[model samples]
Target: MSDSQRFPVAAHALAYMAHKGAFSPAQAAPSALLAASVPTNPVVVRRVTALLAKAGLIATRPGATGGSWLLRQPEDIRLDEVLKAVNGCAHIGSPPAGAKGCPISEHIPRQVGKALTAADEAATEALSKITIADLLDENPVSLAAYTPHASCPVAA
Candidate 1:
Protein backbone atom coordinates (compact mmCIF):
# COMPACT_ATOMS: atom_id res chain seq x y z
CA MET A 1 0.00 0.00 0.00
CA SER A 2 1.03 3.62 -0.48
CA ASP A 3 2.36 5.52 2.56
CA SER A 4 -0.61 7.85 2.51
CA GLN A 5 -3.01 4.97 3.14
CA ARG A 6 -1.49 3.81 6.43
CA PHE A 7 -3.41 6.07 8.79
CA PRO A 8 -6.79 5.68 7.14
CA VAL A 9 -6.34 1.93 6.88
CA ALA A 10 -5.28 1.69 10.50
CA ALA A 11 -8.27 3.73 11.58
CA HIS A 12 -10.60 1.56 9.59
CA ALA A 13 -9.09 -1.63 10.96
CA LEU A 14 -9.46 -0.47 14.53
CA ALA A 15 -12.97 0.75 13.98
CA TYR A 16 -13.88 -2.54 12.34
CA MET A 17 -12.48 -4.45 15.27
CA ALA A 18 -14.38 -2.28 17.68
CA HIS A 19 -17.59 -2.47 15.70
CA LYS A 20 -17.41 -6.24 15.57
CA GLY A 21 -16.45 -6.59 19.24
CA ALA A 22 -13.04 -8.08 18.45
CA PHE A 23 -11.45 -7.41 21.81
CA SER A 24 -9.58 -10.66 22.43
CA PRO A 25 -7.88 -13.53 20.64
CA ALA A 26 -11.14 -15.45 20.66
CA GLN A 27 -12.81 -12.51 18.95
CA ALA A 28 -9.86 -11.36 16.84
CA ALA A 29 -10.39 -10.09 13.31
CA PRO A 30 -8.30 -11.73 10.60
CA SER A 31 -6.20 -9.73 8.16
CA ALA A 32 -8.09 -11.15 5.21
CA LEU A 33 -11.35 -10.08 6.79
CA LEU A 34 -9.98 -6.64 7.51
CA ALA A 35 -8.75 -6.38 3.91
CA ALA A 36 -12.21 -7.20 2.63
CA SER A 37 -13.60 -4.14 4.40
CA VAL A 38 -10.86 -1.91 3.02
CA PRO A 39 -11.28 -3.53 -0.40
CA THR A 40 -7.50 -3.97 -0.48
CA ASN A 41 -5.15 -6.93 -0.52
CA PRO A 42 -4.58 -8.95 2.65
CA VAL A 43 -0.88 -8.19 2.44
CA VAL A 44 -1.62 -4.48 2.73
CA VAL A 45 -3.77 -5.08 5.77
CA ARG A 46 -1.08 -7.26 7.29
CA ARG A 47 1.52 -4.55 6.74
CA VAL A 48 -0.63 -1.99 8.50
CA THR A 49 -1.52 -4.43 11.26
CA ALA A 50 2.17 -5.11 11.90
CA LEU A 51 2.71 -1.46 12.64
CA LEU A 52 -0.33 -1.36 14.86
CA ALA A 53 0.87 -4.41 16.73
CA LYS A 54 4.28 -2.83 17.20
CA ALA A 55 2.65 0.28 18.63
CA GLY A 56 0.69 -1.81 21.16
CA LEU A 57 -2.56 -0.64 19.61
CA ILE A 58 -3.41 -4.24 18.80
CA ALA A 59 -2.17 -7.82 19.21
CA THR A 60 -1.92 -10.58 16.61
CA ARG A 61 -1.50 -14.33 16.40
CA PRO A 62 -0.46 -16.37 13.36
CA GLY A 63 -2.34 -19.49 12.30
CA ALA A 64 -5.59 -20.66 10.77
CA THR A 65 -7.58 -19.44 13.77
CA GLY A 66 -5.30 -16.51 14.49
CA GLY A 67 -6.17 -12.85 13.90
CA SER A 68 -5.88 -9.42 15.51
CA TRP A 69 -7.53 -7.87 18.56
CA LEU A 70 -7.46 -4.40 20.02
CA LEU A 71 -5.07 -3.66 22.91
CA ARG A 72 -7.23 -0.73 23.96
CA GLN A 73 -10.82 0.36 23.72
CA PRO A 74 -12.07 2.17 20.62
CA GLU A 75 -13.12 5.15 22.65
CA ASP A 76 -9.58 5.40 24.03
CA ILE A 77 -7.88 5.35 20.63
CA ARG A 78 -7.21 8.74 19.11
CA LEU A 79 -6.57 9.28 15.42
CA ASP A 80 -3.27 10.97 16.25
CA GLU A 81 -2.28 7.80 18.10
CA VAL A 82 -3.17 5.74 15.02
CA LEU A 83 -1.18 8.06 12.79
CA LYS A 84 1.79 7.73 15.09
CA ALA A 85 1.29 3.97 15.40
CA VAL A 86 1.48 3.57 11.62
CA ASN A 87 4.21 6.20 11.44
CA GLY A 88 2.93 7.51 8.12
CA CYS A 89 5.13 10.33 6.78
CA ALA A 90 1.97 12.15 5.70
CA HIS A 91 3.32 12.08 2.11
CA ILE A 92 5.57 14.96 3.04
CA GLY A 93 9.05 14.44 1.68
CA SER A 94 12.12 15.54 3.53
CA PRO A 95 14.09 18.58 2.40
CA PRO A 96 17.25 17.73 0.51
CA ALA A 97 20.56 18.86 1.94
CA GLY A 98 21.43 22.46 1.07
CA ALA A 99 23.96 22.80 -1.74
CA LYS A 100 27.34 24.12 -0.64
CA GLY A 101 28.04 27.77 -1.46
CA CYS A 102 24.33 28.37 -2.30
CA PRO A 103 22.70 30.67 0.26
CA ILE A 104 19.21 30.16 -1.13
CA SER A 105 19.47 26.40 -0.85
CA GLU A 106 20.50 26.57 2.82
CA HIS A 107 17.77 29.07 3.72
CA ILE A 108 15.02 27.30 1.82
CA PRO A 109 15.54 23.89 3.45
CA ARG A 110 15.33 25.36 6.97
CA GLN A 111 12.21 27.35 6.10
CA VAL A 112 10.59 24.35 4.49
CA GLY A 113 11.47 22.14 7.41
CA LYS A 114 9.90 24.59 9.82
CA ALA A 115 6.75 24.78 7.77
CA LEU A 116 6.50 21.01 7.56
CA THR A 117 6.94 20.68 11.31
CA ALA A 118 4.20 23.20 11.91
CA ALA A 119 1.90 21.37 9.53
CA ASP A 120 2.56 18.07 11.27
CA GLU A 121 1.82 19.63 14.65
CA ALA A 122 -1.40 21.07 13.34
CA ALA A 123 -2.46 17.72 11.94
CA THR A 124 -1.73 15.90 15.18
CA GLU A 125 -3.69 18.46 17.13
CA ALA A 126 -6.67 18.08 14.83
CA LEU A 127 -6.53 14.32 14.89
CA SER A 128 -6.23 14.28 18.67
CA LYS A 129 -9.78 15.50 18.90
CA ILE A 130 -11.03 12.46 17.01
CA THR A 131 -11.11 8.83 18.09
CA ILE A 132 -11.90 5.46 16.59
CA ALA A 133 -15.22 5.64 18.46
CA ASP A 134 -15.90 8.91 16.70
CA LEU A 135 -15.56 7.14 13.38
CA LEU A 136 -18.18 4.60 14.50
CA ASP A 137 -20.51 7.20 15.97
CA GLU A 138 -22.55 7.28 12.76
CA ASN A 139 -23.49 3.60 13.00
CA PRO A 140 -23.39 3.39 16.83
CA VAL A 141 -22.38 -0.22 17.25
CA SER A 142 -22.36 -1.73 20.73
CA LEU A 143 -18.69 -2.12 21.66
CA ALA A 144 -19.22 -3.01 25.31
CA ALA A 145 -18.62 -6.75 25.01
CA TYR A 146 -16.76 -9.30 22.92
CA THR A 147 -18.56 -12.08 21.08
CA PRO A 148 -16.57 -15.17 20.21
CA HIS A 149 -18.90 -16.19 17.42
CA ALA A 150 -19.56 -12.77 15.99
CA SER A 151 -20.60 -13.33 12.40
CA CYS A 152 -18.27 -11.99 9.74
CA PRO A 153 -19.82 -8.88 8.25
CA VAL A 154 -17.40 -8.52 5.36
CA ALA A 155 -16.68 -11.31 2.89
CA ALA A 156 -13.00 -12.10 2.54
Candidate 2:
Protein backbone atom coordinates (compact mmCIF):
# COMPACT_ATOMS: atom_id res chain seq x y z
CA MET A 1 0.00 0.00 0.00
CA SER A 2 1.05 3.53 -0.58
CA ASP A 3 2.22 5.66 2.32
CA SER A 4 -0.99 7.67 2.12
CA GLN A 5 -3.14 4.55 2.48
CA ARG A 6 -1.66 4.02 5.86
CA PHE A 7 -3.48 5.71 8.70
CA PRO A 8 -1.79 8.57 10.46
CA VAL A 9 0.80 7.59 13.03
CA ALA A 10 -1.08 9.56 15.67
CA ALA A 11 -4.27 7.67 14.94
CA HIS A 12 -2.35 4.44 15.18
CA ALA A 13 -1.00 5.48 18.56
CA LEU A 14 -4.44 6.34 19.86
CA ALA A 15 -5.83 3.07 18.54
CA TYR A 16 -3.01 1.29 20.24
CA MET A 17 -4.03 2.83 23.53
CA ALA A 18 -7.62 1.95 22.87
CA HIS A 19 -6.86 -1.65 22.00
CA LYS A 20 -4.81 -2.05 25.13
CA GLY A 21 -7.75 -0.81 27.21
CA ALA A 22 -5.76 2.33 27.96
CA PHE A 23 -8.35 4.74 26.72
CA SER A 24 -8.68 7.02 29.69
CA PRO A 25 -8.92 10.74 30.11
CA ALA A 26 -5.31 10.84 31.35
CA GLN A 27 -3.57 7.71 30.15
CA ALA A 28 -0.11 8.15 28.72
CA ALA A 29 2.43 5.88 27.03
CA PRO A 30 6.06 6.51 26.37
CA SER A 31 7.06 7.69 22.92
CA ALA A 32 9.44 4.77 22.55
CA LEU A 33 6.74 2.23 23.29
CA LEU A 34 4.29 3.78 20.89
CA ALA A 35 6.98 3.92 18.25
CA ALA A 36 7.77 0.29 18.77
CA SER A 37 4.11 -0.63 18.50
CA VAL A 38 3.86 1.14 15.17
CA PRO A 39 7.32 -0.11 14.15
CA THR A 40 8.28 3.38 13.04
CA ASN A 41 10.88 5.92 14.05
CA PRO A 42 10.28 7.42 17.45
CA VAL A 43 10.67 10.90 16.01
CA VAL A 44 7.74 10.30 13.68
CA VAL A 45 5.66 9.00 16.52
CA ARG A 46 6.61 12.01 18.63
CA ARG A 47 5.57 14.42 15.89
CA VAL A 48 2.15 12.74 15.61
CA THR A 49 1.79 12.49 19.37
CA ALA A 50 2.46 16.18 19.65
CA LEU A 51 -0.25 16.91 17.14
CA LEU A 52 -2.83 14.74 18.91
CA ALA A 53 -1.89 16.25 22.23
CA LYS A 54 -2.42 19.67 20.80
CA ALA A 55 -5.81 18.62 19.45
CA GLY A 56 -6.86 17.39 22.89
CA LEU A 57 -7.11 13.84 21.61
CA ILE A 58 -4.44 12.66 23.98
CA ALA A 59 -2.20 13.93 26.77
CA THR A 60 1.55 13.47 27.15
CA ARG A 61 4.06 13.63 29.97
CA PRO A 62 7.83 13.88 30.25
CA GLY A 63 10.53 11.74 31.89
CA ALA A 64 10.54 8.08 32.90
CA THR A 65 7.17 6.37 33.31
CA GLY A 66 5.73 9.25 31.35
CA GLY A 67 3.50 8.64 28.35
CA SER A 68 0.33 9.70 26.58
CA TRP A 69 -3.28 8.99 27.41
CA LEU A 70 -6.57 9.62 25.75
CA LEU A 71 -8.18 12.84 26.92
CA ARG A 72 -11.67 11.63 26.06
CA GLN A 73 -13.58 8.39 25.67
CA PRO A 74 -13.07 6.43 22.48
CA GLU A 75 -16.68 7.05 21.48
CA ASP A 76 -16.13 10.77 21.90
CA ILE A 77 -13.11 10.81 19.60
CA ARG A 78 -13.90 10.75 15.90
CA LEU A 79 -11.58 9.14 13.39
CA ASP A 80 -11.70 12.24 11.22
CA GLU A 81 -10.22 14.33 14.00
CA VAL A 82 -7.29 11.96 14.29
CA LEU A 83 -6.86 11.84 10.52
CA LYS A 84 -7.03 15.63 10.23
CA ALA A 85 -4.53 16.06 13.03
CA VAL A 86 -2.00 14.03 11.07
CA ASN A 87 -3.03 14.79 7.53
CA GLY A 88 -3.91 18.41 6.97
CA CYS A 89 -4.95 17.92 3.36
CA ALA A 90 -8.26 16.28 2.51
CA HIS A 91 -7.55 15.40 -1.09
CA ILE A 92 -5.03 12.63 -1.64
CA GLY A 93 -4.30 13.31 -5.29
CA SER A 94 -2.97 16.48 -6.89
CA PRO A 95 -4.52 17.96 -9.97
CA PRO A 96 -2.63 19.96 -12.57
CA ALA A 97 -2.02 23.43 -11.20
CA GLY A 98 -3.12 26.72 -12.77
CA ALA A 99 -5.94 27.31 -15.25
CA LYS A 100 -3.87 28.80 -18.04
CA GLY A 101 -3.71 25.65 -20.18
CA CYS A 102 -6.69 24.76 -22.37
CA PRO A 103 -5.73 21.25 -23.44
CA ILE A 104 -8.75 18.99 -23.88
CA SER A 105 -11.86 20.63 -22.35
CA GLU A 106 -11.05 23.53 -20.03
CA HIS A 107 -13.86 22.56 -17.68
CA ILE A 108 -12.95 18.87 -17.64
CA PRO A 109 -10.01 19.08 -15.28
CA ARG A 110 -11.77 21.59 -13.09
CA GLN A 111 -14.82 19.33 -12.85
CA VAL A 112 -12.63 16.32 -12.16
CA GLY A 113 -10.81 18.20 -9.44
CA LYS A 114 -14.09 19.20 -7.92
CA ALA A 115 -15.27 15.62 -7.99
CA LEU A 116 -12.05 14.47 -6.36
CA THR A 117 -12.43 17.07 -3.68
CA ALA A 118 -15.98 15.94 -3.07
CA ALA A 119 -14.85 12.35 -2.83
CA ASP A 120 -12.20 13.29 -0.33
CA GLU A 121 -14.77 15.17 1.70
CA ALA A 122 -17.04 12.17 1.57
CA ALA A 123 -14.25 9.98 2.87
CA THR A 124 -13.59 12.39 5.72
CA GLU A 125 -17.29 12.43 6.47
CA ALA A 126 -17.35 8.65 6.58
CA LEU A 127 -14.44 8.68 8.96
CA SER A 128 -16.28 11.17 11.11
CA LYS A 129 -19.01 8.58 11.54
CA ILE A 130 -16.54 6.19 13.12
CA THR A 131 -14.91 6.49 16.51
CA ILE A 132 -12.16 4.74 18.38
CA ALA A 133 -14.95 2.84 20.06
CA ASP A 134 -15.97 1.41 16.72
CA LEU A 135 -12.40 0.27 16.23
CA LEU A 136 -12.39 -1.39 19.62
CA ASP A 137 -15.55 -3.27 18.77
CA GLU A 138 -13.79 -4.87 15.84
CA ASN A 139 -12.07 -7.63 17.81
CA PRO A 140 -9.52 -5.40 19.51
CA VAL A 141 -7.26 -5.34 16.51
CA SER A 142 -4.20 -3.13 16.36
CA LEU A 143 -2.54 -1.14 13.61
CA ALA A 144 -0.44 -4.25 13.20
CA ALA A 145 -3.49 -6.04 11.79
CA TYR A 146 -3.46 -3.69 8.83
CA THR A 147 0.21 -4.32 8.04
CA PRO A 148 0.98 -6.23 4.90
CA HIS A 149 1.83 -9.86 5.23
CA ALA A 150 5.51 -10.80 5.24
CA SER A 151 5.19 -12.76 1.99
CA CYS A 152 3.05 -12.22 -1.07
CA PRO A 153 1.06 -15.33 -1.85
CA VAL A 154 -0.28 -13.68 -4.99
CA ALA A 155 3.18 -13.82 -6.50
CA ALA A 156 3.23 -17.57 -6.30
Candidate 3:
Protein backbone atom coordinates (compact mmCIF):
# COMPACT_ATOMS: atom_id res chain seq x y z
CA MET A 1 0.00 0.00 0.00
CA SER A 2 1.12 3.56 -0.70
CA ASP A 3 2.01 5.90 2.13
CA SER A 4 -0.76 8.19 0.95
CA GLN A 5 -3.50 5.59 1.30
CA ARG A 6 -5.07 7.23 4.31
CA PHE A 7 -8.45 5.67 3.79
CA PRO A 8 -7.19 2.12 4.15
CA VAL A 9 -4.94 3.03 7.04
CA ALA A 10 -7.70 4.83 8.87
CA ALA A 11 -10.16 2.09 8.09
CA HIS A 12 -7.74 -0.49 9.44
CA ALA A 13 -7.22 1.56 12.56
CA LEU A 14 -10.97 1.80 13.13
CA ALA A 15 -11.52 -1.87 12.44
CA TYR A 16 -8.80 -2.72 14.91
CA MET A 17 -10.52 -0.60 17.50
CA ALA A 18 -13.83 -2.22 16.71
CA HIS A 19 -12.26 -5.62 17.17
CA LYS A 20 -10.05 -5.08 20.19
CA GLY A 21 -11.81 -2.25 21.97
CA ALA A 22 -14.86 -4.46 22.23
CA PHE A 23 -12.99 -6.46 24.84
CA SER A 24 -11.62 -3.54 26.82
CA PRO A 25 -13.59 -2.58 29.90
CA ALA A 26 -13.44 1.08 28.80
CA GLN A 27 -14.22 0.18 25.23
CA ALA A 28 -10.99 2.01 24.38
CA ALA A 29 -7.74 0.84 22.79
CA PRO A 30 -4.31 2.44 23.05
CA SER A 31 -2.70 4.20 20.08
CA ALA A 32 0.41 2.02 20.22
CA LEU A 33 -1.81 -1.01 20.01
CA LEU A 34 -3.75 0.57 17.19
CA ALA A 35 -0.50 1.40 15.36
CA ALA A 36 0.63 -2.18 15.67
CA SER A 37 -2.49 -3.32 13.88
CA VAL A 38 -2.00 -0.69 11.16
CA PRO A 39 1.69 -1.66 10.99
CA THR A 40 2.30 2.07 11.21
CA ASN A 41 3.78 4.53 13.64
CA PRO A 42 1.94 5.65 16.76
CA VAL A 43 1.96 9.20 15.40
CA VAL A 44 -0.04 8.19 12.38
CA VAL A 45 -2.51 6.31 14.53
CA ARG A 46 -2.83 9.33 16.81
CA ARG A 47 -3.38 11.63 13.83
CA VAL A 48 -6.21 9.55 12.42
CA THR A 49 -7.62 8.98 15.88
CA ALA A 50 -7.79 12.74 16.33
CA LEU A 51 -9.67 13.04 13.05
CA LEU A 52 -12.15 10.33 14.12
CA ALA A 53 -12.58 12.02 17.47
CA LYS A 54 -13.18 15.43 15.91
CA ALA A 55 -15.76 13.90 13.58
CA GLY A 56 -17.51 12.34 16.59
CA LEU A 57 -17.03 8.88 15.15
CA ILE A 58 -14.71 8.02 18.01
CA ALA A 59 -13.72 9.36 21.39
CA THR A 60 -10.22 9.86 22.83
CA ARG A 61 -9.03 10.09 26.38
CA PRO A 62 -5.61 11.43 27.40
CA GLY A 63 -2.88 10.22 29.78
CA ALA A 64 -1.77 6.78 30.85
CA THR A 65 -5.25 5.42 31.44
CA GLY A 66 -6.67 7.06 28.31
CA GLY A 67 -7.04 5.76 24.78
CA SER A 68 -9.40 5.84 21.80
CA TRP A 69 -12.68 4.05 21.15
CA LEU A 70 -15.62 4.20 18.78
CA LEU A 71 -18.22 6.77 19.71
CA ARG A 72 -20.81 5.61 17.22
CA GLN A 73 -21.93 2.06 16.82
CA PRO A 74 -20.39 0.18 13.90
CA GLU A 75 -23.75 0.06 12.14
CA ASP A 76 -24.14 3.82 12.38
CA ILE A 77 -20.69 4.92 11.21
CA ARG A 78 -20.41 4.93 7.43
CA LEU A 79 -17.14 4.54 5.51
CA ASP A 80 -17.73 7.81 3.69
CA GLU A 81 -18.02 9.61 7.00
CA VAL A 82 -14.69 8.19 8.08
CA LEU A 83 -13.08 9.05 4.75
CA LYS A 84 -14.30 12.61 4.95
CA ALA A 85 -13.16 12.86 8.54
CA VAL A 86 -9.68 11.81 7.52
CA ASN A 87 -9.72 13.71 4.18
CA GLY A 88 -8.95 10.33 2.72
CA CYS A 89 -9.53 9.38 -0.91
CA ALA A 90 -12.59 11.50 -1.71
CA HIS A 91 -10.54 13.93 -3.79
CA ILE A 92 -10.42 12.42 -7.27
CA GLY A 93 -7.00 13.87 -8.06
CA SER A 94 -6.32 17.59 -8.26
CA PRO A 95 -7.90 19.50 -11.15
CA PRO A 96 -5.58 20.13 -14.08
CA ALA A 97 -3.20 23.05 -13.50
CA GLY A 98 -1.04 22.80 -16.58
CA ALA A 99 -0.20 25.47 -19.17
CA LYS A 100 -2.12 28.40 -17.71
CA GLY A 101 -1.42 30.51 -20.83
CA CYS A 102 -2.72 27.87 -23.26
CA PRO A 103 -6.28 27.92 -24.53
CA ILE A 104 -6.68 24.25 -23.67
CA SER A 105 -5.82 24.88 -20.03
CA GLU A 106 -8.96 26.90 -19.34
CA HIS A 107 -11.35 24.45 -20.99
CA ILE A 108 -9.48 21.37 -19.77
CA PRO A 109 -9.55 22.40 -16.14
CA ARG A 110 -13.25 23.29 -16.15
CA GLN A 111 -14.30 20.08 -17.86
CA VAL A 112 -12.01 17.85 -15.84
CA GLY A 113 -13.08 19.46 -12.59
CA LYS A 114 -16.71 18.88 -13.42
CA ALA A 115 -16.12 15.27 -14.36
CA LEU A 116 -13.94 14.54 -11.34
CA THR A 117 -16.38 16.20 -8.97
CA ALA A 118 -19.21 14.08 -10.26
CA ALA A 119 -17.11 10.94 -9.92
CA ASP A 120 -16.06 11.86 -6.42
CA GLU A 121 -19.65 12.44 -5.35
CA ALA A 122 -20.74 9.14 -6.80
CA ALA A 123 -17.89 7.30 -5.07
CA THR A 124 -18.74 8.95 -1.78
CA GLU A 125 -22.36 7.91 -2.19
CA ALA A 126 -21.34 4.31 -2.75
CA LEU A 127 -19.07 4.43 0.31
CA SER A 128 -21.89 5.85 2.41
CA LYS A 129 -23.95 2.73 1.89
CA ILE A 130 -21.33 0.68 3.69
CA THR A 131 -21.30 1.04 7.43
CA ILE A 132 -18.47 -0.15 9.66
CA ALA A 133 -20.74 -3.04 10.62
CA ASP A 134 -20.92 -4.06 6.97
CA LEU A 135 -17.13 -4.06 6.83
CA LEU A 136 -16.96 -6.38 9.83
CA ASP A 137 -16.14 -9.93 8.81
CA GLU A 138 -18.14 -11.24 11.76
CA ASN A 139 -21.72 -10.93 12.88
CA PRO A 140 -23.11 -7.54 13.84
CA VAL A 141 -22.64 -6.44 17.42
CA SER A 142 -24.16 -4.21 20.02
CA LEU A 143 -21.67 -2.16 22.03
CA ALA A 144 -23.08 -3.24 25.36
CA ALA A 145 -22.45 -6.87 24.60
CA TYR A 146 -19.39 -6.50 22.37
CA THR A 147 -16.47 -8.86 22.68
CA PRO A 148 -13.44 -9.76 20.60
CA HIS A 149 -14.11 -12.65 18.27
CA ALA A 150 -11.41 -15.07 17.18
CA SER A 151 -12.71 -15.52 13.66
CA CYS A 152 -12.81 -11.82 12.92
CA PRO A 153 -9.22 -11.11 13.87
CA VAL A 154 -7.76 -8.08 12.04
CA ALA A 155 -4.35 -8.76 10.49
CA ALA A 156 -1.48 -6.33 10.45
Q: Given candidate 3, what's the lDDT at residue 121?
A: 90
Model 3 lDDT per residue over 1-156, tens place: 343566777788778777775434286788888888778888788888888888888888877777888876777788889889887665657775868679988678889888888988997887787777766655533223455457666556
Q: Candidate 1: where are CA atoms >4 Å away?
A: 96-99, 139-156
- Candidate 1's TM-score reads 0.82
Q: Tell me the spans in candidate 3 whose CA falls farther than 4 Å from its real position.
A: 1-3, 23-25, 138-156
Error of 1 at 87 (Å): 1.4
RMSD of 1: 8.3
Best by lDDT: 1
Query: What are the TM-scores, per candidate, against the unseen true structure?
Result: 0.82, 0.74, 0.78
By TM-score, rank the candidates, best first. Answer: 1, 3, 2
Residues 20-54 of candidate 1: C-alpha lDDT, one tens digit per residue: 99999999999999999987898899999999999
- Model 2 residue 122 distance off true place after TM-score fit, in angstroms: 0.8
RMSD of each: 8.3, 5.4, 7.1
lDDT computed for candidate 2: 0.72
